[model samples]
Target: MTLFEQSGTWRPVDRAAQQVQTLSFEMPEGVTAFRVGLEFDRSGGGVLDLGCDGPHGWVGWSGGERSSVVISEEWSTPGYLPTAVSAAEWHVVVGLHEVPAAGVDYRVVVSRATAADVAAERRAQPAAPPVPERPPGRDLPAVDGMRWLAADFHAHTLHSDGALSIDELAALAVSRGLDVLAVTDHNTTSHHAHLAQVGERYGITLVPGQEVTTDRGHANAFGDIGFVDFRRPGRQWQRDVAERGGILSVNHPLGGDSCWRMELDQPTAVAEIWHSSWHALPVLRNWGGPLAWWLSWGKDTVPIGGSDFHREGSDALPGSPTTWVLCEGQDVLGGVAAGRTAVGVDPQGPVLLRVGDELMALGADGALLSTFEEGRRRIVGDRVVLPAAAGPWWLEDDHRCVLALCL
Candidate 1:
């Protein structure tokens, strides 16, 4: 095996600027596979979009979502071509976006394997785990003839940069106690066809959705609708998704590198009020983009949550902050459309429920809570019963952190 590793520093780049960091490596005979891993500081306002080129050209590209990938003779990561990784010089290109004034730093590791090593890897790949049938939505409460369905509306699969296949995702979702899982791959709906089989096998409601990932912003489209055109304008996506009876959401509008910077004069269908990124983004960074935008549009703007689950090593899960949707049937997207949903801290955590003029917590007792209505929110303690008219406010933790969005 041959390996090369190095640490490099990148100067501050403008909002849209490209930077290149190259590693020159000479290969010995009989090398069968080449793998690459790029690690960087996602905090401190530096987000890198990366692609690599071998002696030939175009090894792979994992935009922000992935930091490592393996390329073999016949197959590579999706969005990349798997061909002969000829022995020669190679280059890794980095697109620096949203860099802080202090500059960005990164580490690159490239490794090559022999035939025996590659064969061992093939044999070592674990077999897919069995997915158990899902039980009735776990820990959910029935409110006014509506049962709150727990769903993770944003996730990816091997069809995109996700490490898990559809089958693996199903198994993981079942283990995570999710009743619904939406596989919203980046810019493609190719995974939609397999949802029925996979979801049925796992006994969970599979929601078909697509992340219209673009350079400007990102959105999630959910439904049985066909492929959505990501190259189209944002308004077109909203119009087309609505026409197809699907729902759309501006995801992580205030995220670091994945922030939704696009401006569409038309109203947004929904907004990701609580994304897992909220807790992890750099502290220096302003994490109030989507909330500010939603407030600008008033409380009518439907809100949801997505962990954007791609893997397990990270603290993020399919429903780290579970989305509880009020559904008459098992249709999770239908609840999203009707704006009868609230985002909670976790599957087993507190979920604020609004039944008529009364406010209550489901599965949460003595948890710090608050209330939000109109554009303003006030922090309330562990008090269970909210006064009348205070009934319509979102529940927040101390420091106004989003505990459960009752609105």
Candidate 2:
């Protein structure tokens, strides 16, 4: 039964007045499930984000990736969480991401559903891909008991906007030779529940994460910490994530459109200085932008990398710029917290790592090891070791294309 329905035209003026608007409806008593559907004039070149909020607080958000979502006690859509139906006011939160000058008409419908309806509308889980044999582990030296783990700190799945399911994403990460893959869906933690089971099946660690998204910027909250509120200020996100025992990393600070433009009194401890967006242009064109941002951001900032992978042919594949963390076992977050990380062009590409007060450059013969404190030095051999100094070091080719980064 239809409980609430609304239709209106949203314009640029409305968006400027209020970025997010909510349509409220009282959930009927004894309802087994509920569904919210949003329809907007896509032809008008407008973008609308969809989400739900129960009386308790944030339920889920799919950004512009989904138009409709269903919730029940047993099952819910990928971007939403399943919870027991409650008799209270619920809200359909709409974000006017982009509104055309001419305005765009939109409609939102909220309906009650039965168990049978939810079962009929449930999406089937995708089959897991065959596990591929992993390549032999790298022999890079680490302190006494720690080992280097190849990780990709940013990637998405069907839980947000990516093309694959959690199972498929884990398999793909394993196949790409990643030891850890942080599943950071956009503004939601629905994917957190499935990480352990799927990671165990594919023999890789799937760290729970959420991409705290906003029009101003995007940040990644890493670990099993609950959802970080996207509507909050950027500084609040850093505080909340840290309070919840999770680490926040500013993502793709120089990413056009999605860059870090939000103001923060103090910089986040971690930042993704190397992103797959750099691949969209010529190698040498924007290589220095992220480096420049990092230098100005803070001296002790821990630099990381991510592919920001979504679907095939969209962004760089997982592990395209692998983040190697030196940690014990599967403690990828712990490694990140301690600032023990290095990034390479790919899992098997040239890398610069800090080892016991010395800098080791591997697979980087003929490349230049450049650091801010010390001047550039030509790496003559495949494996070269140099006296370590204060660093935000990188290995770049003759064309100045960055191949590896170490913090």
Candidate 3:
């Protein structure tokens, strides 16, 4: 017999990311078995998490790992701990991960059974590996009296969907000659807690980042500042991140299916037009749409690159086309936000930087420069007219291979 059957659509707002919405329902007397479930009806846009807390404390938190869950005295949802369903004001917690400007539409289903034993739900992901000691620092070149720090602004660990541990990722960064790394997990700031200790030991500026992820698009919030909810609108994020002394970037807008579809309400700080995609990125011309998108918002939105390092493979590893930030001290994010940056094809390859009125290609071994619009060819010099490099352009080798791109 049905004990509690209810459903409704929740239209979350800007502050919903840090909120815990609770729907209370009483457990009827003689309830032998209990079950709770949540479902979403949308094509693709944002992300919302699900969990429950009873009179005692947390009962289940499945996140986006599972759609619905069954909870009773015997078992519960995957990634959740089952407990006795006491008769009290039980609470259903909706963990808002992403809520679009149009809001989200959802439903909840809670019911009971006469007699049944719940099956063992899928277990939580293995506990994240213990943080390891910091590795020795690596060497990198200094440019224009300022350090050309090799950094990766987009990466992940087990705190999200990555396979490596925090320490493991750090070790790999060192191998890849990265001077700085940003741990941008899917949607949670839980990884930030371990950054200080681990980053100090690893000798790299481990900038705490959160990938404000949803089906419609994804972005990276860079800094060690406090958590920012992913459920708010994109405009809210740009404003909130800046107010908190952090920077924001639209990530991999040209990625298939995951390409950014969100409208730009404000002029953001950065754009990840060059990601680790073999078919699309700084090394390819498949970024016209996204480049035009950023260009439409004006030059305030600086173009940047990220390896999008999740795990080490041949597709792309950490710091493949390194982002060279010209900064004093350790102001990596500051350099990116200010557009004082350049991207190289590899860690030790040539880089294209805009110095004063000239677009300079340093250490390029005499590579050719060309515009994406095919307007002109700069086949003879390390410096091109600042006018020619205004829009989107690329540096290439003798074989016509794209080395680095700037938008």
Best by TM-score: 2
Summarize candidate 2's per-residue lDDT along 1-407 as a digit string, tens digits: 89899999999999998888888888888887988899999997999999998888788988889887889989998888997779999989999999999998999999887787788767465767888888777778867789999999999998888999988888888888999999999999999999999999899999999999888899999989898988888988988888899989999997878888998868998998888876667854436888889899986799788888899887899998899999987788988989999999999999899987889999999999887765688999988989987688899887878889896
Where model 1 places Cα greater than 4 Å from the true spot, the runs are: 1-127, 132-139, 281-290, 372-392
The deviation in Å at residue 98 for candidate 2 is 0.7
Q: After superposition, how far is residue 274 of candidate 1 from its true place, in Å?
A: 0.7
What is the per-residue lDDT of model 3 for residues 1-407, given as tens digits with 9 covering 90 to 100? 55555565556554354445777888877664576777776555757676667777656455655566666665554334456777787877776666666777777777774333363332443443343443343243455677667888788776565767777788777667788888987666657767778777767788889888765689898887655555567777777888899988888886777787887566566888667773334456333454466566665567777888767664578876678787888888877876777666667666776655566665565677766455435545443344443645667766666677664
Angstrom error of the Cα, residue 116, model 1: value is 21
Against the unseen true structure, what C-alpha lDDT does each candidate score? 0.70, 0.88, 0.68
lDDT of 1: 0.70
Arranged by lDDT, best first: 2, 1, 3
Reference-based lDDT, residue 333, model 2: 90
Q: Candidate 1 on 231-310: residue-level lDDT in tens? A: 56888888888788888888888776677777675767578878887765456123455556667756677778898887
Q: State the weakest 10-residue window (summed lDDT) of model 2.
A: 278-287
Q: 1 or 2, which is superior by lDDT?
A: 2
Candidate 2 lands at a TM-score of 0.97
Which candidate gets the maximum lDDT versus the true structure?
2
Model 3: residues >4 Å from true position, as ranges? 1-145, 278-290, 372-393, 397-401
